[model samples]
Each structure stands twice: as structure tokens, then as C-alpha cells.
Target: MSMVNQTQVHETRLSDAVNRIAPSGIRRFFDLATSMDNVISLGVGEPDYTTPWNVREASIHSLERGLTAYTANAGLIELRRAISTYLTKRFAIDYNPDNEVVVTVGASEGIDLAIRAIVNPGDEVLIVEPCFVSYAPIVSLTGGVPVPVPTEISNDFMVEPEEIVKRITPKTKAIMLSYPNNPTGAVMSRKKMAEVADLVIEHDLTVISDEIYAELSYDDEHVSVPTFPGMWERTILISGFSKSFAMTGWRIGYLCAPEPYASAMLKIHQYAMMCASTMAQYAALEALENGQEMMDEMITSYRQRRNYFVKSLREAGLSCHTPGGAFYAFPSIKETGLTSEEFAEAFLMEERVAVVPGHVFGVGGEGHVRCSYAASMSQLEEVVERLKRFNAARIGR
Candidate 1:
């Protein structure tokens, strides 16, 4: 035997699933942005604003009172009750706090728990791409195969019901959706949502709706998929305080679903996470209770940014559709004779401007780059100039 010692018999390495998960391509640009000085970054998706004062104050108070004990595995009842009321009043969606809700570390966790709860090994979950980077990998981690359906900018990236139905097979178990979508700020209309709801009902498929950006809508009120007829029983609604309350670091979110599903998600959640941060839960409770004015103010700022930034991209000779929701603007760079990754790298390396390459978000994302308007207006203005200059160098503008 060639040095086959007992210690060498066991190899410490990542599992196949972990190794197969595609790394977030946004991070490379982010690392580059961090290492360079005098660079204006519109790469990361975090809001530039600090958490609203009242929300921060509540968490501080919680700390001062030494309220650091572990909450119920489901989370504090008070927070759950607040969320229950908020959803009912705001979206006309009702869920009993006792059996239908579970607070998660973030909408991210809620999504993971919900998937692991429903998807069996080899089960198929339909996802719309250029979507959130985490959606596919998370599904894979649960031993469920992620099936992506392409959605394009020509149609504004709305998930079509026909495309979904064509992809459905006997192995199909659920559809995962995020709208207003990340990377492209597309928000599905209520009528279109109803159509998808009908498809789900027809297939008897479940929908895991990630409404993390629901409060950031610039047009009509955000619609929840579960609110449609007969869809409630099949939809798992996931949202959180991060976007609206500017509480991204708080890691607080919740999921609402009917019995068994909610109960199932909670079981995974309780064992995996124990509970979300107690102080953050209290902070989220405060956000739900008293942060409306602050949330509205932030949404107003994002709306202004969206209008200005999208207009700038169009005027600069790039094709960009004004997003109806969220803070990102995804514009095609194909006309410049460069792929999304090459464009993003050259744009950063030469102009000292950083943005995320679109392909990182999955299908229908290539030939474009995702820019976050969550940065300050000054940074955004500089970004437009740099992007225009970069485009001119590569292709006649």
C-alpha cells in the first residue's frame, strides 16, 4: 500500500452539492471595488441608508434590558402578531400567528427552510432567471434539482405562465419566484399574477413567493401570489424587514403558509436556526409597529433614483427599461462588443467603476450588467459618465 494510513483514509472536503454550487460572481467585482480607492461602487445590493433611528433605538433598548434570551423556536409571539396584522392590513392576506407564521434569519432562510420542507430528492423547482443568485443553489443544496425558465428584458423579465406550464413534468414540485425581481427590477402585475396563480392551481403546484422587495415597489401595490383564489393553500409567502425598514443587517424575516407547510418549515427552522436573533426580532417588531413613515421616505428616494438612473442609461446610448420596482437597473452592454463579465471587468479596471455582471443571476442575464441605484446620487452620476466613456472606447457611441 502506498502510504494508505488510517488518517489518510478519510478526506476532508466539501460535499458534491457544496462543490457544485456556483459562486456568486458579484463578489469578485465587490472585492476589486474594496481593494481600490477613489472608486464609485454600484455593485452591492445593500441600501446605503442606515437602519431607521426608531428601529435601532428599539434594539438598543432590548439590549439595555438584557433581553438576550432565546425566543420561542418559532420566534417571539409579539413579533409574529405584529407581522400577522401588517400582512392582513396591507395585503388583505390572513394567517393565524400561532400556526401559520415562523420568523427566519432573513427572507433567505425562510426560502431555504420552505424548500427543504417541500422538495424531495430529485424533485424539480421552476425558477425564473436572471433571478436572485441564491435561488438555484439553495434548491440544489436541498437535493432538489433547480429548473430555470428564461425571462428576458424585451418583455421586461416578467415570468410568463405559458413558459412555466411547458416546463412542468411529473417530477415538478414547486415554482420559486422573486418579484419585484432582483438584478432587473421587474414587478409582475396583479392580472399577470392571477394568470400564474391559475397555472399553479391547474397543476396543483406550490409557489414559494419571495416578496422581499414588496415594499420597494414604485408602481401599484405589490401583489402576493397567495392572495389569489385557491392559491393560499399552495403558496408560501416570504418577506422581511430588511428592504423597507433599511434593516438588512438585522437578519429578520418571516414566512406565512397554511398548516403542514408552515409546520414543516418551522420544524426545519427550529432545528437548524433555533430562532432568529432575539434583539433583531424585537427590532423588527418595532419596525412593523412604528416604521411606516421611514419606510415610505426610503421608497420615495428609490423611486427618484430609478427615474433618474434609467433615464441616464438610455440617454447615454445603452438600452435600459425603467424598472417598476426595487433599486437595480439592468442594462444591456451587448452593443459594445463585450460580454457581461468582460464589460464589468473593463468598466471597473479602467474607469474605477464597479458593477455586477448580469450572468451571475442566471439565464437571460448575459449581455447586461446589474447596477444598484441604492448608492448615493453623486456616485450614480459618476457611474453613468464612466459607463458612457467605457462604451465609446469599445464601440462608437
Candidate 2:
């Protein structure tokens, strides 16, 4: 102060866009669960399984071979070819690895890049909820309006074409979809996906389809929205090795879109990310080549957990729909007469169980909490018992 407050001279102002977004609503429960002993947590969306040995070994071999240098701005052409082949074989979509694919750090980054590259200042992106918490904030960061179109539990929280149709306006530029969805393990059926695809075609809107949980679908075959007739050109298909291969830390994801958008996104990616990690890229290739057996085993386990969790949650007084995919159980906590946040906080503090409040996921998510079964069976069972106790305690039992 005596020196005329020179410290104030370089005070930086953050942009309004950053200021506009709220911190994740799940942070408080997560923080409370941190380092707490005897806490049975279903709060995290991580696969408890480690990455397959073969996949990890490939990365180790790459590092041992000193393949540490950056590959290309769009990533290794060989890796891209693998991705191209994988998508076509798995989801029946075609993309030229040479020009149409860009390896991103994660599907998370691919989502951000897609929106930023195409959305103008005033354009709007319709986000289906309750979704992965990052979608809206990232859209906001790109100066696009984040419009949430809510789905219902009556329909297992699947997004309907009508809900999306009512929200479309002149400013609507794209629609972001994730299925099997996060928070809610709801998958868009092929028929339903086709309906939305038709709507997109009619409106001349782009669709950013995030299929990170593609391999985890349980009851129905996971449909790639881009596979619909006339949908490939307008779909920015995003997927990764994370969920399927238990490769979350590998941070390898990809985008496949038609020209101009692909080229445009690459420009931003080249200047920003340069390329995804070299060793991780190689690991992804290995996952594509040899990890199917491991992925199948993990999916089988997750399906068993899904069956147990849904039945136990309902019997314990929480209403949960049997999720067709992913590993989350989004049960209504409204019967306990507590808000989603209130119930989550109380559950973590009293019963020592952690879960995410659904309200954080966006509109139409209140009155529910998301419990993940991505933990061990013992942990999931114990959490259910704790939630039963929590529900009983609320009623003075």
C-alpha cells in the first residue's frame, strides 16, 4: 500500500464465460467422502477394474522403445486407421482415417473442440440431461448457449424426439447426446435414435454423439446414431477407450466428421493439443486389437451388478429403473422428503456412503441421486444396506 499498491497493477480479469458456470454440484459430497474411513462410495463414475494387461503392456513397450516423440497434429496415421476400422467393424460407420479422424486427448476434449469449432457466438447447443456434468459448462466456454432438454424416468430417462423438437429455434446449431448416458444409464434405442436423426436432418442441425459407453450396453444393442440413413455426414461421432477397455487414464479419444468441420476442429486441436499422448495412442491401438475379451468380461460383471443394485435399491425404498447400459443407478430419493443434495449429504455423513446429487446434472434432475455401481460388489451391497439404514432413520425406525 505504501508503494502505491503495485501488487494491484497486474490484477487479471477472468472472462464472463468462466464466471457464468457453476462448480459441479457433486463436489461437496465428494470432498466430504475424501479420506474418510469406512466410507462405501458409489459417487465416482470410474471403472474399478484396471486397464487390461495387454493394453498396458503395449504402452510399456512403446515407452521402452523410446517412442516418446510427438506423432502428428492429427495423431498417428496408423492409429487413425485402427480407429477407422474399429468403428466400421463395431458400429458400422465409415470414416477416412486420412482426413476425417482426429485423435483427441479424451472424448471430453473432442466434445469441447466440436462445439468451439462450429458454434458461433449466439448459437445454441441442446444438451440432453441428466448428463455428464461437463457438457453445459464446456458449451458455455465456447460462447454457445447450453440448452438442457430433460428426459423422464417414466421412459427410463431416454431422450425423446418430441422433447428435442420443441426446443429447436433459429439459433439452435447442434444437439449433444451421450448414450449409454451418464448419471442415468439410459440408452437410446435404435428406433428412438433414428427418430432424432430424422429430426436433425429436417432441422439441418449437427449432432455430437458421445458414445464413450458404447461397449457397456446391457439389454439392447448400442446403436450408433450416425448409422441412420443420411445421418453420417452431420454426426460428429465421439468415443474412446476409457469405459470399454478400463483405460480412463490413457486419455485417448477420437472424432469422426465430414470435411470443413473435421478440418476446422483440427486447426484448433493442432494449435492447442498438438496431438494426444504417443504411448497412450499405441495403447489404444492395442485395446482395439486385443482387448475385446477383457471388455466382454467387464461388461458381464457390470450387468450382474446392475441387476443386483436395481433390485436392492428398490427393495430398500428407492425407486430405480433397471438401466440398460453404463453402471449408474439413478433412483428417486424424493420419497424420503429430501432434495437430491440434501439426501446425498445426509447419506454421506450418516451412513458413510457417497453418491452424486442428480440436480447437478441439469434441469429435471431434482428429487433424484445418482449412485454408481462401478465399485466392487461388496462395496455396492454395503452401500445399499447403508442407504436402507439412511431411509429407515429418516422415518424414525
Candidate 3:
């Protein structure tokens, strides 16, 4: 006789926070775009160039030397020292390599750790609207409230100190800052950064500054908010090799902060993941040392592409503010009477060109779209022609 089983069973249960998070809206469109034929994709934020030869050679050398074992929790000491030196040389930000820096898997991990380190459940994290898509979901996953403050094309998408000051309440714990910003490509000025630093000091709030695109500034110099007096102690500065060195797949990033907070973040780093890849760390050291020439060349190309793409979009009857930094151009397409998603879809379907809907970035982005100019000049030229044809048809209809 078959007897009924009497054993107790257990099943996997995902955290409610995980359930609440949506897959990246930026990525969702790319996945759909790839299945189509003859698609000219400007949807991705990746650099179209291959990783520089020197950086690739360094990684290869590390692998040949069998430097594949797990690294120390804070990452390779040499890589940390390289990071500290690079930031100091480039941004004039001071950080001690031994105690104050932790190499993360990527800036993405740095964001997670910063939010998790300081936020207690129910605390609020302030974000700027038309922001990178990850910040809100990551805050929510850390059990913190995500408070978005809208910036505008009129102000060039730069946040005002007063807007940040007003967003604070007793529950507000920290602010997430990204400059040479993704999607919008807006940059923070030194004076504005100082104002933000002043506000943070007045309220005694922490800052998670993501400067991954720091090296991509086209027309302006990038500033670190932490350089302002008293802010070094209150800010966790995040940057990585991905954007500057065209090393996205390598996934090497670092965080710099003062004292107990740094220690707290390192604890999370140690437990969750021991370190970033060993070879990648070695390769990042080379990237920090020998990659500046490559970066300067790439930046020069990106600037030309930026100028060309913005002109092309305007010629196509779209209004886009020329971005000050990063590789994306966020253009307003509301005149087409299409929602951002519908506009992106129709653009792709009709012109065989892929650009992301700006709403995917956040709420204030409804009438806009983001296209990366990181592609080759030839591709950019071709995309512009397709857009012009698409616009002609759109206007006729």
C-alpha cells in the first residue's frame, strides 16, 4: 500500500524587497530590440570600443602568472593603492589605501553596500529624477524609502541645493549622487557640488557619490562633492574602470570613505563576496597606470560624436540639450505625440534604430529618449539618417 508522506517540506521564499524590484527598464528594451533584424542599436550604454590593448595584455599577464585565487576582502593592495593614487592625481580627493578603500565588484556593488551600510529599515534615500534606474530599486531593497526630486532640461538637469534641502525629513538618511550622469549626461559643477556639500553638512546626512563617468566629461571638468570641507568624512565616493577605460566586462570598481562607515562596508564586502576578480584587479592597476592615453583618445572621439549626434537629432526635429558629459544624448520627442515607450518602439520598428525611452530612467522622463553616442562615427551617421527618414514619415502622418 502506498502510504501518504508525512515529512515536513521547505520551499524557497524570496524577500519581499526582491519581489518589489523591477528588472532594469533600460535592459528590458535592449532585450526586445536584439531579436529584430537590421537593428541599429543606440539603446545600450556600453562603450562601442574594445578594451584597450594594454589593459587586455595586463589581464592576460595576470592570468599567465596564475593570479586567479581569491583576493583579500578589501581587494588587492596594489589595486587599492593604484585607485587611491589615481583619484588623488585626477580629482584631488584624499583617501588612504589601507583602511579607507575597498575594491568592489563594480560600482553597482558599491551602491548596494553604501545604502545597506547606513540605512536602517524605513530610512529615506534622496535621489534626483530622470536618474539612473538602479538607485531607487537598490534603496528599496535595503528597506529604505526612495525619495525622488525632479531636475529639468531648463536647469540642464543639475540638482539645486534647495531642492535637496527640502526633501529631507527625520527619516532621510543619505543622498545618491551620480554625475556625468547616465541617461541625461548632466554634470555637477564645483560650485553646485560645494552647495550640496554645505547642505549635507548642515543636516549631517551621508552621501553616496557615483562618479563612474567622471572621466567622460566633454565640455566641463567633473567635481567630487567630497572635496568640499567636512564632506570627505560623510561621503562614499564610487568609481570604476568600466566607463573610463572601456573595461566594462572586467567589473572592477572601488569605494572610498572615512572611518567606521568604511569598516562597516568592508564587513559586508568580506561576508557577501571576498573580493573582485583577482586578474581584473591586476588589470585595473594597469588601467589606472597606463590607460590615460587611451582614455584621452576615446574622450576626444566621444566629444565629436556627441556634437554630431546632437546636431543630427536637432536636424531630425528633436530637441536635445547638448550633454556636458558622458556619452548619451537625452532628447525630447514629445512633438511626435507619442509616449516615450511608443516613440522608442516606433522608432525601432520603422527606422530599424534602437534608442531607449527616457521614462525608463524615472518619472520626469516621459517625453524623452536616450541614445548613446558611444558607437562609431559611421554608425552615428547612419542612425541620424534613419532618424531623419523616420521623422519625415512621422511628420507626413
Best by lDDT: 1
lDDT winner, 1 or 3: 1
Clashing pairs in 3: none
Q: Give TM-scores for every candidate, taking all chains together and pairing residue i with residue i.
A: 0.96, 0.96, 0.95
Pick out the ten consecutive residues of candidate 2 with the lowest summed lDDT.
3-12
Decreasing lDDT order of the candidates: 1, 2, 3
Residue 231, model 1, lDDT: 89
> What is each predicted model's overall lDDT from 0 to 1?
0.90, 0.89, 0.88
**lDDT for each residue of candidate 2 in 262-370, tens digit (9 for 90 to 100):** 9999999999999999999999999998999988999999999999989998888888888899989999988898999888888888888989998999877899999
Question: Candidate 2, residue 297: CA error in Å?
Answer: 0.4
Task: For candidate 1, list the clashing residue pairs, or say none.
Answer: none
Query: Best candidate per TM-score, number?
Result: 1
lDDT of 1 by residue, 138-231 (tens): 9999899999998988789998888998899999999998999998999998888899888888888989999999889998888888889998
Worst 10 residues of 1 by lDDT: 5-14
Pairs of colliding residues, candidate 2: none
Tally clashes: model 2: 0
